[model samples]
Target chain A: MTKTHYFYIGYGLLCLLGITSPLLNPWEGATTVWDRLYLKFYGVSPYGGFSLLSFLFYSIIYTGFLYQFQLFLTDYLSGRFYYTAIRYQSLARWFIHLGWQMSYKAACFLVVLATVTVLIGLALGDSPELTVSVLSNLTVIQLLIQFLLNGWLQLMNGLMIVFITAWVFKEPSYNLIAMGLLTIAALPVLNAGGWLPAGLNSTAYLSGQWEDLILITMKLVVYLLIQLVVIAVLFKRKNIAFY
Target chain B: MKLIEVVNVSKSFKGIQIFNQANAVFEQGNIYGILGPNGSGKSVLFKLICGFIKPDQGDIIIHPSYRSRRADFPQNFGIIIDRPGYAAGLTGFENLKRWAEIRNQIKDEDIKRTMRVVGLDPDARQKMKSYSLGMKQKIAFAQAIMENQQVLILDEPFNAMDVDSVKVLRELLIKYKQEGRTIILTSHNEEDIELLCDQVYQIRSHKLVPVNTMAKV
Candidate 1:
């Protein structure tokens, strides 16, 4: 990890804290940890009308650190890729290790987010106990799973986007195509709830239904698998010409 | 004893051929020098030998004893192809430690010793971003030799170094060769080729042609 990685983590903490502060304050809002989490993820609904500005703000903030990960991949490829790649006997192993690093970083960020949310709830004198909420009929385990899967899968999808774009465009500037696709997917007119990459990140698409959540999980897995397969195929033959 | 053989290897990028049926033999306990002008596929040949890139038409055969059961690339080979990939925020010691952890074969003491060998202060707190080009090159050279790799494939191993540093590295390369390690390298300077390399090959017209070292000078 580099010094810049710490900056990204710090930035993520600040963003989480800023967003959580208003929603979990003692004066006028969510009284419990679960309530705070539920409200935080209560993003725009497609069936109901959507707020363009609010969705855009949350989406960008949520996925901003991911752009840094993409940039890191690009830099590593250009610089020390050969240095590291040759240490391993096979490039496939190196690629797998890279994927693992991304996954680990993604999981760590989610943990940090959750930890901050809980700490804020504690400071606000919100109850530590996970309580029943009328916001949606989600059990504690189900809600936790939903939150984790949504956050992790979104980050992984973001990584997949970087790899696919790099393979196709062979340059970092091509990541703009990924950003544009994300923006286009955010529009509610597409009605692409949980199917498109951007729509899959929306909490509203989760819908608190076991069947819906399961379906969404399957869809996310399938989408991520397809993207991973595409990347593996393209990258298998790619010359290590990052420099 | 033959170590790595590039048998009729051919490669191209974007329809521009880099090598065509190029073949070379690298044997053990010898420092073989590759000489070619810029864009003449010297680096590409090194990459193929290291399995960083595959040849389009032929195989790069590695001796069975050097082949690892775990990976497609040969085991126990130190390599320097392009830029050294050190984290700018990390000190030289920290960077080496991270890479050493990959193989889990060396300890902190080994790293410190290797740093010392390269004339770097192991305890220095200076980050890699603050390092001079020469200092970075030393770090790159340190990592390649730290594990005592049996084979070293270095491209432009003498790049960006002072005269004294180059001399120190030359003596070290001779010591390594004395230990019976296979070393293949490329350098723009004929002095490096003449002083260190036991045999030399010059790349011409997509082929590896052995140059009579004594006659070339």
Candidate 2:
């Protein structure tokens, strides 16, 4: 990957971090509702102590970093494939890469519309009153943009595996298995419900910046681990041409 | 109008002149042969007609009936220049399937029919890596004949073929000619040139001349 591309990804993370600082003090009305929900749900020991916007922002930026890491790493894997194939055509392979990005963004748009509709319905009480203002929901937009940006990057990495199998891979059957792994790794985390835990900021047993760094790093590490295994499994099959 | 016209087309390489000033008219249904020595610009001339390369100072015009525009060189001609290259990782059938999808020519059953015509194993989904040189040549031939093109240009189409395979290609070319399809084939072998060409052109000193009156036998 280019140095300029790496800078862009880092800049995106820094921008998200700046936007998330203001969620430290949410609206009083939003705070009261959260307090009541915490009391009813978890016997009032601050079960839902934080704002929803904070969690959403944290997950969005965290996943964004991992997404850039995946792109850089997969490019290495793809470069290996390109040199090994007897007559690999990058011209044809480009289309497969582009198609994945287009489809990913189209899904992200539908998800954004659905999130806004759900938030609006909950804020209103079947009257024509506009209770929730736009600025408070500003963090929601940040959550979605990061999802889409990272989602496309992950999809590109996934399709790179398919391209390698049909074009550069010496063995044929492993293509199917590698593609299965890619599909699972890139599945959207948005629709997994509360059971899977919120992506970046689930209430852990610890708190503060150190806890945040440890948790975020761990998530990034797991994401990279999955990608490494996928590449290694494909690379070590037999006489890996080392191209 | 002539089906295809080449007016004063010339090309040079470094300081050497290959085709200085050449003109030819090709009519429909003629089996024109390009005959010359090993480095006599036979392949270069074919590339010029296929629009793969450009002449230094002239225009090539295929008749409107032959093709609508110049960018559609691929549509007008079924050609082989230099050598036939295929994606070795893909099976011949898979390679042909992608080609069909690109060209919108020869769907499923048409592919089967073309395979039969060229005597290749349509069911041979084996990666082209396992194919012999002759088998790869046959695959290119099968692709070239897919859409029943009106004009065919082939450069040394039988370079790596065995006796039986050569005979099959000759018969295939003859069948296309019998249907009044304009064809051009270039080769150095006297026998192939004699058997396939109606009129032979010699590239001498960057000029193309019909070989009716050579100075020697």
Candidate 3:
């Protein structure tokens, strides 16, 4: 099987393990393998035994990794495709225009993913209080806006990393290490600065923290616009010859 | 009328000069051959005309009527330069389909017809990664002509093709020329140049020197 297929299988198994482990060992003091695994990674006790929160956090981070992996794969494949497509003299400018096309696709994928995950969460009979509180705190429109903002930010971040690395490195493989380093370095800053709203932090927006949401949304938009302009200008000036 | 004019174009890579004050002109409805040895700026010239690279000290001007602007690619351009790259996981038809979707100028039948013209199996399910070198070349050719563009710029397009395939492609190109499309091709093959080009220029000393095939004959 392809690496992507293996990844999906492994991710699905992990999700199943996360959900079922808590149910299997429901006693307050009893600890399951999932709890132990979570402790090892998080260095904290899993709240509520087989905590759905912990599982959700793990899933979000894993999804980020998956998104990055797919971005890398698509960039590599599209670069190869563009290497020849650009040869079609009329398509020489296509590399610059690809940003919007990819962003649109990523946005659609994010919406579908969010809807499916929410549906699955409902089906799994998540905590009644958790679901009620979440639903009560934010209307559907607010939730959608937040979800779209979060997805756009994620997409912009991924694109920025690829574009910056592509500008610097001649080989696409070199950008993998650069992407890893950038993600590692950016995560702590984004979290500490309250830029990224994953896990429990994401729940804050539902409780009428519109100010923070608006501020973050504005910053992300400005940053993405600047990055897009830089990428377009650089690509226009760069010589794209296959070696 | 001139379709493309390259005026005093100069280009270099990390201090290695490729072209210095090189100039060339291509008129409409003519097959122009650029003849040069390897690493002699034939490909560079093609890249300049295609707006793939910027010239250091000059401008490439595509006729305003043919192209929208001075800085943009000419409208309806079909080109094959270097190696043809495609998504490794996609079938040949899928790859072509993606490109066709971009412009929305051609239909599925056009794609299939071009594939047939290039002797590629349109229904083949094999991924592009598994395609042989000859198959890849044929697919690239299929992409170039599928749109029925007014201009074609091909760089060593016949590389890795068998004799029969090459003959078929040559005939196809001749047909494109007869239909009044401007075609520019770079080749080391003398026979291709003799049989195909209406006007030929040899790349000499970073400048184009016109060749008279009839005088030589």
> Which lDDT tens digits does candidate 3 get at residues A152-238?
675556666565566545556666675555444334333455443222213233334567557656766766777767766766675
lDDT at residue A37 of model 1 (Cα atoms)? 62
> Candidate 2's residue-wise lDDT over B78-117, tens digit each?
7665555565567887766766665565678888788777
Off by over 4 Å in 2: A1-243, B69-74, B213-217
Clashing pairs in 3: none
At residue A198, give the lDDT of candidate 3. 26
- Cα lDDT of model 1 by residue, B1-217, tens digit: 8898989999998899999998889999999999889999988888888776789999899999998786757889998877676878889999989888888899999999999988899999999998999898899898899998999998887689889989999999999999999899999898888899889999999999999877664
- At residue B18, what lDDT does model 2 achieve? 81
Best by TM-score: 1
lDDT of 2: 0.53
Question: What does the lDDT read for residue A191 in candidate 2?
Answer: 19
The better-scoring model by DockQ among 2 and 3 is 3
**Which of candidates 1 and 2 reaches a greater lDDT?**
1
Q: Which window of ten consecutive residues has the lowest lDDT sum in model 1 chain B?
A: B66-75
Model 1 misplaced regions, further than 4 Å: A1-10, A13-31, A43-45, A121-134, A167-169, A191-193, A234-238
Order of the predicted models by lDDT, top scorer first: 1, 3, 2
> What does the TM-score come to for chain B in model 2?
0.92
